[model samples]
Each structure stands twice: as C-alpha cells, then as structure tokens.
Target chain A: MAGSDGSNGSKEKSNDFANELPSYNAENMQSNMKVIYYSRTFMSIIGGVIAGILGFTGLMGFVFYFLVMAITSAGIAAKAGFSVHLYFDSWNLIILDGFLGGLMSFVLFWTFAYDIVHIF
Target chain B: MAEDLVLDTAIRDWVLIPLSVVMVLIGVLRHFVSKLMRTSSQLPDPKIVKEGQVIIRARNLRAAANFIPLKSFRARKVYYSNEENGLLFVPKGQAQNAQAQMFSDPNMAMDMMKKNLSMIIPQTLTFAWVNFFFSGFVAAKIPFPLTQRFRSMLQNGIDLSTVDVSYVSSRSWYFLNLFGLRGLFSLILGEENATDDTQRMMQMGGFGFDPSKSLSAEKDGLDILQHEWALPKFEQRAETVLRKLVS
Candidate 1:
C-alpha cells in the first residue's frame, strides 16, 4: 500500500493515455493481509521466547520485540523484491499493529518460558 | 501476608512437557485434517462469469477514467449507463434478484457447513480430552507476578487459597497453548495454514457465516457509484504535479 500514490503520480505523468492505473484488488489485499498477519504473529512468538530467554523484561522486552519485528519486516520486504512500499502504504502501521496484535501471545510464551528457564 | 512456595521438578517434566507436546501434536493433526477437508471453490455459471467480467471492466474504467479525455470518458460512461444498450446496466431489482440467487446457492451453504464442522469438532475433542485426563492438576507457573484477581481464572480446578496466582492448572495451560501455539503452526505448516486459532475465533464471531453478504455489499457499492468524469480535472491535477516536480 506504500508508494501506491507515487505509482499513481508517475502513471499520470506518463504520456500513455491508454495505460490503466491499477485498481485496488480486494481479494489480493485480503490475501496479503493474511500473509502479513500470520507471519508477524509467528515472528513475535519466536522473538518473545528469545527475549525471555535473554531475561529481558518490562520496557526492554518491548524494545527487543520491535527490533525483531523490524528485521522480520525487512526480510519480508526483501522476499517481495523490495515491494513492501507497494504492498503496505504505511510501515509504521504495520509495526504498530504487529506490536499490539502479538503482545498477548508474546507475553504468554515469554512468561512461561522465562519461568521454566530461570525459576525452575 | 504470603508464603514462599516450591513446585517440584517432576511436575515440569511430567505435566508441562506432556501438555505442551500433546497440544502441539493436536494442532498439527488439526492442520492436516482441515487441509484434507477443504473443498475447492466451485465455479459459477458461465452467465454469471460473463456478468462478473462486465462488472470488472466497468470498475477498471472507473479507476482509469482520469487517464482518458473528457469526451472519451463520457462516451464510455454512456456505454455503461445507457438504459437501452449499456453493456453493464441491469434492469431494476436485478441486483437484488442476483443476490437472492447467490444466497440460496447450495455450494456456498455446503462450504460454510464444512468450515464450521472442521473448526468445531477438533476444538470440542481437545477440550474434552484435556478436561477428562488432566483436570485438577496445576501444570506450570507464570514467570511474572499476578494479582489475586487472576487466582480463580488461572487456578481453575485447584482450591488452594495459599497457592500462588502464577501457578496455572492443566485446563488453563491447555487453553493458553491453544492460542499460543499459532507460531509453531506457522513454522511447521507455513503462514496460510488452516489451523489458525485467531482466524477460527474470527469465524466464530459471525464474520464467516454468509459469503453472499460481502457479495451483496459489493453490489450495493457498485449500484450507488456515480459516474463522475475525472477527465475534466485531470489536466488541472497534471499541471499542479508538473509544477511541484519542477519546484
């Protein structure tokens, strides 16, 4: 969804009158959302486990999660041939949503793993 | 006000490990079961397909309307909105009739039923099994401290008031793993696996019942769309863009 406006701007500037601006495909958008949602969930869980094992807690844990999330997003962007800007209009939204969405799972796994490793 | 408590290592090995393992195994099994149960999408009739194509074309025209000159835009708009010969225009109430036909489509109904069955049966079985075999035993302790309010929710079967709120019972642990194991499923089965608990919960929340609801919604959207000629403003917008680029 990023760079869509840029793409539209360029399309308008181009002299090809017959060239159609790509319309938003709802089905394609839904599938992309599913991919990002699940992938972010998966990454957050793993990241939480790692953070817990490293004994990160409170604010540090949140910071570590964001770091991991950035790497995951970069990896996804690379896989998509640097088209993240095309697929996602706002990187901030993705990060914010991923952080909030995965908080519960992260906390659950992090607490359990932390206790099992350190307390026992 | 509180006493220090110690949980045996044996509980970790016997209870926690086994519960986690069983939960993961069940999740993997459910993934495969749902995959096997998935029915391929049925193709609509040829007439329906043709009608869909017309709608798509009209949509594309609307999206690219600014690209064409105003005269051409008007011509295309007349071609679509013309009462007598428009390729995309339908008779009054035809949209409603199409939605009604889609609503009663047996294939759609069957697909919804299959999805519901796949989601419900495994969840029921897992809950029953956990309750029957592992109920009343505390499985694992949460690492962080919790207030006394969580004691009843986390320690479901155990009646010990002295027990720490962090010590969760087997049933609660099972439920936790139910939602927490999504990452494991994604790792093992890939991102789009059918066993996603969140997706199932969303479905259960009534979003997944009727496919025709969305279809009708799209139809309504199309019906209400006005044929605004974007080409008239295209020149002005292009001039501003050029000015900005030069600046």
Candidate 2:
C-alpha cells in the first residue's frame, strides 16, 4: 500500500509538470500550428478585402490598424504563451466582435437585405 | 432739388436688396421648420437594450467530476483574470471539499459549470453588446475634437462584464473556459497541439477559481469598481495561485 501511494504521488507530480509545458510535445505542435495558421490567414483575408476597397488610403489604414491590433494581441499571446484565439474563451469576445462586426453586418444588411426589405 | 434726387435713388436701391434678403430668409426658415417636424415625427429612438440575458446550452453536463460545496461564504470583489474567464467565487467557508474532490474527480464539477454557463453566457454577451453600442459607439462617434476623451469617459463610466453562476451542475475544470473569447480561442486552438502532458492534466482539473456568495446590485456595482481599483493585487493573487498549482 505504501509503495502504491508513492507511485501515485510520483505520477501526480509528472502530470503537474506536463500541464505547465509551453508547447505540446513535438507530436502536438502541428495541431497548434494549424490553429495559428488559420487565425492569421483569416485576419489577413479580412484585412486584404478592406484594403482593396480603401485604395492606397485604405491600404495605409489597414496596415496601421493591423499593426496595432497584432502587436497588442501578440503581446498577450506571448505573456500567456498561448495562441490569440484562446483570449476569446471568456465569451466577452462575442460581444466585442459582434459590436465590431455590426459594422459589417450593417453594411451587408443595407446592401443585400435592404432589397429584400424593399421587396417585402 | 439735387439732394432730394440722390436720397430717393439710394432708398430705392436699398429697398430691393432688403426684399430679396427677406425672401431668402423666409424660404430657409420654412425648410428648417419642415425638416425639424419630419425628424421629430419619423425617428423613434432605438430601443435601449439596457438589459438582456443569454442562454448558452452546454453540450455535456454529465461529464464533469468535481462537485464540492463550500461551507463558509465571503464575497470577494469581482476581478477578471484573462487566464480564468469568469468571476471567481471564493467562498470563505471551509475549503475542504473543493481541494480534494475538485482535484481528483474534476469531470463532475466541470459539468456544473458547463450547465450554468450555457445559461449565463448568452445573456451576458447580449447585454454587453447592447451596452457597448449605446454607450461606447455613441460616445466614440460624438462629433468633437475631444471624441477620444469622451470615448474613454464612457468606457470608464460603465462596467461591461458582470457574470454570476447561481448553480453549476458540478465544480471542476470545465468552468475554466469562462475567461473570454481570446482565452477560450487559445485553449481550443492550443489544446490540439498541446505537447505538455502536465499542462493537459492541469487543464483537466488543476486550475479553477473559488466560488463566492452572490452580491446585491449595489454590492455588485461596488465590486466592479473595486475590481478595477484592486486589479493589480488580484492579478498577483492569480499569479501566485497559478505558480503554486503548476509548479
């Protein structure tokens, strides 16, 4: 019984150490990489679309906004040693994003949904 | 005879100009009055969504393991930790059931949070958006050179996040997901590639917040203010807790 208790203690310690590691072992890095890749790609696409519409001025605005947002978000990611997406885990992001996204939603509603409203 | 002739011509010319000016003024006044009446009659103020609630259904409530109940109750000032998404409820009670049961059998405890979260999160998000637009967006768009100041003032004026979980099905690690979108996003994205077994285990049941007694509206408002004021101290507490648990 004593020996079993000792083994359990050791196993627990090992488990604790496992949780604190910054990166999943080499095997798991690919999965994490995919998340980061997708987030950055999505952000880039949005930024590019906005830039195309804004012209040179829009390009400048995109660069400026992206730099500020990226720097702030990346700093947070570094401090947490985690990806940016995890910050949204709190559920607060949905509100923040929705409010911010409301800009797009409004534009979409005006352009697409307005016709439907008019027709109806 | 010459003085009378000069005076007559001057008066006649001034009369025509004044007549034109009066006509223009009347036209402008009429337009403004009509516009004002239309504006007043047409636009109703958008309904002020001062209060709203969200119901987030948990996919799995039965999976959580921890269900420890606290004995004593002390309401801690509400503070947000990006690491821990939701407000911590630190009951000043006997901390017995929490430490062991929460650590060893976490799944049951997590289920409780998941169940309550499904209910709490949706409402909180909706109210937050309504508040954000009416409060933040309006303030930011105020046409003035000092708009940024107004935005900051408005931001400081209201507390955006207020979350309370009355009854969770359990009390385990799943509750850790409450931190924020960024935090949850990080967890989901990072969990897939997590190499550290220790971190994975910690995620399982090691990290959790102390539950607190519910506060009244006045108490809750004060708590938000106190949280902003005591933020540094609260963060230190979190860092210490994380260190002790992870190390």
Candidate 3:
C-alpha cells in the first residue's frame, strides 16, 4: 500500500530491469489457446459418442463427461511433458479453458448417437 | 421420469440421421459458399489506421508502463493524452461520423452487403427447409432430464403438452444441431470457419469499425491510468528468490 514516498523517496530507481520480467507474445498465446480448445473439444466429442454408444443415462452421462475430461487433462499434461507453463500460459488454461464450451456439442452428439444406437 | 414415448427405429433411420446429415452438409456448403462470396477487403483509410495504431500504442504503454522508468512513462502518457497534440485527442471535426464514412465508401458498403447476404440467405433457407418438412414430429430424446420450462424449447414444432420435455421435435433438433455442432464444425473446418452464425451475428450488429469512437474511449482510459513503477518491488522479490535458491 506504500508509495515511492515511503523510505526510498530520494533513491533514483534504475529502469533497465524491464528485461528481467517474462514477456509473452500475443500471437503465441492465442495459438496455445486454440490448441487447448481443440484438444478439449475433440476429446469431449469422442467421449460423448462413446457415452452414447454405451447408453449412459442421466447423471451417469455427466459423470462420464467429467471422467473423460479428467483423462483429457492428464493427456494434455502428459503431452506437455508436465511443463504446462511451457505450452500454455497457466495451469488453468490446460485444465479448464475448453471444458464448458465443449459441453453443448457433447450433449448434441450424445443425444444423436444415443438415439440411433439405443433408442429410436 | 415417465418413459412411455416409443419412437420408431424407422424415425431414427429417417429423421435423426437425415436431419443431422443435412445440417452438417449444409454447414459445410455454407462455409464454402461464404468463402467464395467473401471479397478481398480494401485497406482502411490512412487517417483511421493512424488513429487506431496510436490508440493501440497508448494501450501498450499503459499496460507496460510500470515496467518502464517513471519519467519515461510520464513522458509517453503526456505524448498520448496531451491537450495540444496527444494521440488520443480527437479534434472536433476529426471525430467524423462513421456512418457517413460508410456511406461515402461504396466498396465498404458492397463488402458488408455481401457478408450480410451470405449470412442471411443460408440461415433463412435452412430454417424454412426444416420448418417445411420436419415441423410436426418428435425426432429424438435428450439423455438428460430438464425441467418443465424446457418443454417449449425442446419441442418447438410439436405442440403436445402430454410429451416429456426431453423428446425433441424436428425443428428443435435442427436448432440443437445448429448450436451443438459448433465443436464438430471446428473439428471439421478448423478455426475461423465461415459457417459460424454467432460471430456473423455479432459482426452484423456493427457494420463498420469507428476509429474516432475508440480513440475517445482510449483517451479516457489513458487519462485515468496512474503509472506506478513496479520494478523496485520486483527487484526485491527477485533478489529474495535468488538468495533462497543460492543458499
């Protein structure tokens, strides 16, 4: 909460330290996001299709979705060689970014394949 | 959960498969059609580009201002938001109406018209096609149980209050495939595909970008931004980290 007026008022700070902090490229960050999005979306679509083929119903289907997503996270982490920061901006990006966005498509395909294989 | 709706397997072969296939095919067709229709956009006005870039530079300065020296940050801030020649300042006539500019440029108008045509035509055609042939039957049932509020949503064309909310009508199935196949499309077409109606809807809302409006907004942001040099704090933190590592 203190300012430059604290104890270091008279100290003339050096400005060359900007190089010390890590800087990220916007384009590279976006590329990482797109990769993660797909990794999640593609995996979830496969999970939904499998769930449908297996005739998972109600809460069981949701649980399967989470389980599938967990596997996806593990796969991504493994693919990244456990250094998530090297490929993604943060741990959250790898674990959670595309999880919810894939849900709608998952439900759609789930119902479609389920109806075809199990129901009408 | 009453499980009494018996759907014919024939309906699966006919309605479910055909509807989903048609939707996917139409999506691919629309993507190709729109890509074919998209004209190469001309370069924006030099003045607008200058204004836009200045704003972006100011934004960058504001975000990274703490990393730079306090004196340099103050100099840059004044250079951007200064009353005399600040980059963010839009002199009276400089803030011209974007609509007037849009009308003045026939090429811009034509490009927007083409975009609108590509977006609207396929949507109207698919909606009409779905409503025409598949308007009365419940096509498929969702695996999840939704509340009664979802009845109207899941059963758009079929008007049977006796039916469960999970049983989707053909028209509603079209909609479900409409939104739900976004991931599949991305898988098939990759990112920035033309088949995305949602992004086009957002684009249709704003016909053209207005540099002056953004300039004024960026001006306010830069004006309020207080620059505090954070390097000193970071230096101390880094020293502590190094000390811990070395010890």
Candidate 4:
C-alpha cells in the first residue's frame, strides 16, 4: 500500500535486473555458514594434528596446515562430483574463509599433539 | 635450555587418549543436542518481504545496468528515482519507524537468548566437569619452547613455580581439545554438523544477529543508490572487445 504505484516500478526493475545479471540467484547464492564453520574447524584441527605428527614447528607448522587444507579442499571438490569451479563458486565462504579461520585451532591441536607424541 | 621429562606410556593410555576420545564424544553429543534445540526462524511479514525484494531488485539493476540497452537502463533509473513512482520512495520517516520496531522486537530478543543459553550451558558444563575431575595434574608437555609470558596461559590450574611452561595440566588439555576437535566431529558427523565451538563462539560474539543490520543497510543503500546509467557506452565497449578479438 505504501508504494502502490511503485509496485509497477519494481516489476520493470526486476525484469531489467534479471536480464543483466542472469548468473546471480539469491537462492543458489545462499551458503550455509554454520556448516562451513564446522567443516573448516574440523579440517584445521586434523591438519594441525597431522603437522604435529610430522614434527613441524613454528612457521613451518602453518605452512603444513595450508598444505593439508588445500588437500582437504581438493577432496571436498572431488566429493562434489569434481565440479571444483561450481563448488568453489557457490561455497566460496568455506573455500576462502576456511583457510585463515582455522589457524588457531590448527596451532592448538598441532602443538598439543606434538607435545604428547614426541616430547612427553 | 629446558629439560625434557620422559612420561610413561601408561599416561598416554590412561590420560591422553581417553581425554581426546571424551572430547570428541562430547563434541558429537553437543552437535546433536544443539540440532535438536534449534528452532526454525519465523517468516517475516509479507509487506516486509515485498519491501526487501524491491530493494534487492534495485540493487540487482544497479549491478547489471551496464549490460542492458540504454533505453532499458534509463527506464529502470526513472522508475527507481521518481519521487512519486520509485520502488524505494517510502513515506518520510517510515523506514526509520520500521527499523525501530524491528530493533525492539521481542521475538528476536527471545531467539538471541535461546541461542546464548544453548551455547553457554554446554560450554559451562564441559568446563566444570573437566576442571572437577582433571585439575591439578600435569598431563602433557608442549614440544615447543615458550617465554615466561605464556606460563599463566599454558600452565593453568598448576601453581608450581618449578614446573616447565611446556607442561600442560589436564584442564588445559581439555581446553585445547575443545577448540581442536572440530575436524574429528566433521569426520564422524559430516560437514556443517552443529557441534562446532568456534561457530558458537562467533555467534556469541554477535555475528549471528545480522537481520536488523542488513535491513538498515538495505534502506541506506536504496537511499544512496546512484542510478547513473552505464549502458550508453556499451556499444563502444563491445566494438573495442570485438576489435581486440579480430586483432
């Protein structure tokens, strides 16, 4: 009721917008942030433990974490029918944010595992 | 140089492995519990949904305005910028009133409270249980060296001055496992499983309460959107691209 005349305006604008950006779909663009957060956390912890088992320390440990993350991302991509492009595009939140977001968890687990396995 | 203390294999079997397993089990349990606790969000009013769609359509037009023909771009610009007929031209102060109403909505407040309770209850219980059963004992040592600055953080609950900073108490180990067990949960529960502490922490930090922020942002964006058409130069750009291809 506020924009009775404007409703027609919206119809026109919506058509123009649709024609221009045919690739962008709001429903398809929606990524589950909760899932991405959990998966990234899991991957980073696993990566950290692996790095710890490999006896990596300091900056080398972080480098190892990224390596493991890349492998994990590749595995996820493969699991999604090898449509790496589509998966990365749709799930960019996880693919991009997951890299640095899990660093703290990686370091924590890596250092903990290193201590338990090698030192103590 | 710090000295290395050789811990027996019995400590690994009795303390370290059990602690790790317990942490993972708790994480899996928390995931299922939280999932059970989660309630679906209530749908917004149809009026609000229509308003949101109008703003979204305007934004989409702005982004893709360059691709359309000049006449089409101008039509959208005219429609959006007309004070009487513009999709976003609401009655003065109406947006502010709606925003205020949303900010004070009690249902939103209740949702936030419920989420906080879910995260806090599990976390507090886990912390208390770990501290009660596992306090006072040095369970494991960190392989790396640290300065005296980390003595308080790494050696929590242990009051001994002679104990190495590398030696972590059981409570600290539990804390470490709490933060680091996301991957094991993922392996067992699959991706996006609800048991992640990091996500809960992020939610607690107010990252989850974005509806109001986004609504306000949408209003601001529509208010400021410059409808300057980009399609007038499209033919020129297309010719240049074709020329480059031919060359």
Order the numbered candidates by TM-score, best leading: 3, 1, 4, 2
- Please give the range of 10 consecutive residues that has the lowest summed lDDT in model 4 chain B: B204-213
Off by over 4 Å in 4: A1-46, A57-99, B40-42, B96-105, B182-247
DockQ result, candidate 4: 0.28
Per-prediction DockQ: 0.31, 0.02, 0.52, 0.28
Residue runs of model 3 more than 4 Å from their true location after superposition: A1-22, A83-90, B1-3, B195-208, B230-247
Task: Give the least accurate 10-residue stretch of model 3 chain A, judged by summed lDDT.
Answer: A1-10
- Candidate 3 lDDT over residue span A6-46, tens digit each: 12112122345423444555666666566667778887888
| Ten residues in sequence with the least summed lDDT for candidate 2 chain B | B50-59
Cα lDDT listed for each candidate? 0.67, 0.30, 0.78, 0.64
How many residue pairs in model 3 have overlapping backbones? Answer: 0
Per-residue C-alpha lDDT of model 1 across residues A5-118, encoded as one tens digit per residue: 212111113344433434345555555565666667777787778877887756777787778778767765665556444555556634555556776678777766775776
Better of 3 and 4 by lDDT: 3
Write down the RMSD of all candidates, one decimal each: 6.6, 27.6, 8.5, 9.6
Scored against the true structure, residue B123 in model 3 reaches a CA lDDT of: 77
Candidate 1, residues B1-247, lDDT tens digits: the string is 2665666778777777787788788777777877776646666567666665666777677666656776777787777766676675555544444335548787866766887787788888988988998889777777566799998888888899988788789888888887777666776776557666446657644323432333344345445655544456677888998999999
Model 1 chain B: worst 10 consecutive residues (lDDT sum)? B206-215
Put down candidate 3 lDDT per residue, B126-218, tens digits, no spaces. 899889887899889889889989988889977788888888999999999988988888878877687665586577444336777777788
* Model 3 per-residue lDDT at A72: 81
Model 2 interface CAPRI class:
incorrect
True-vs-predicted CA distance for residue B79, candidate 1, Å: 3.9
Task: Put down candidate 4 lDDT per residue, B128-173, tens digits, no spaces.
Answer: 9878877888888765667888888877899988877878888888
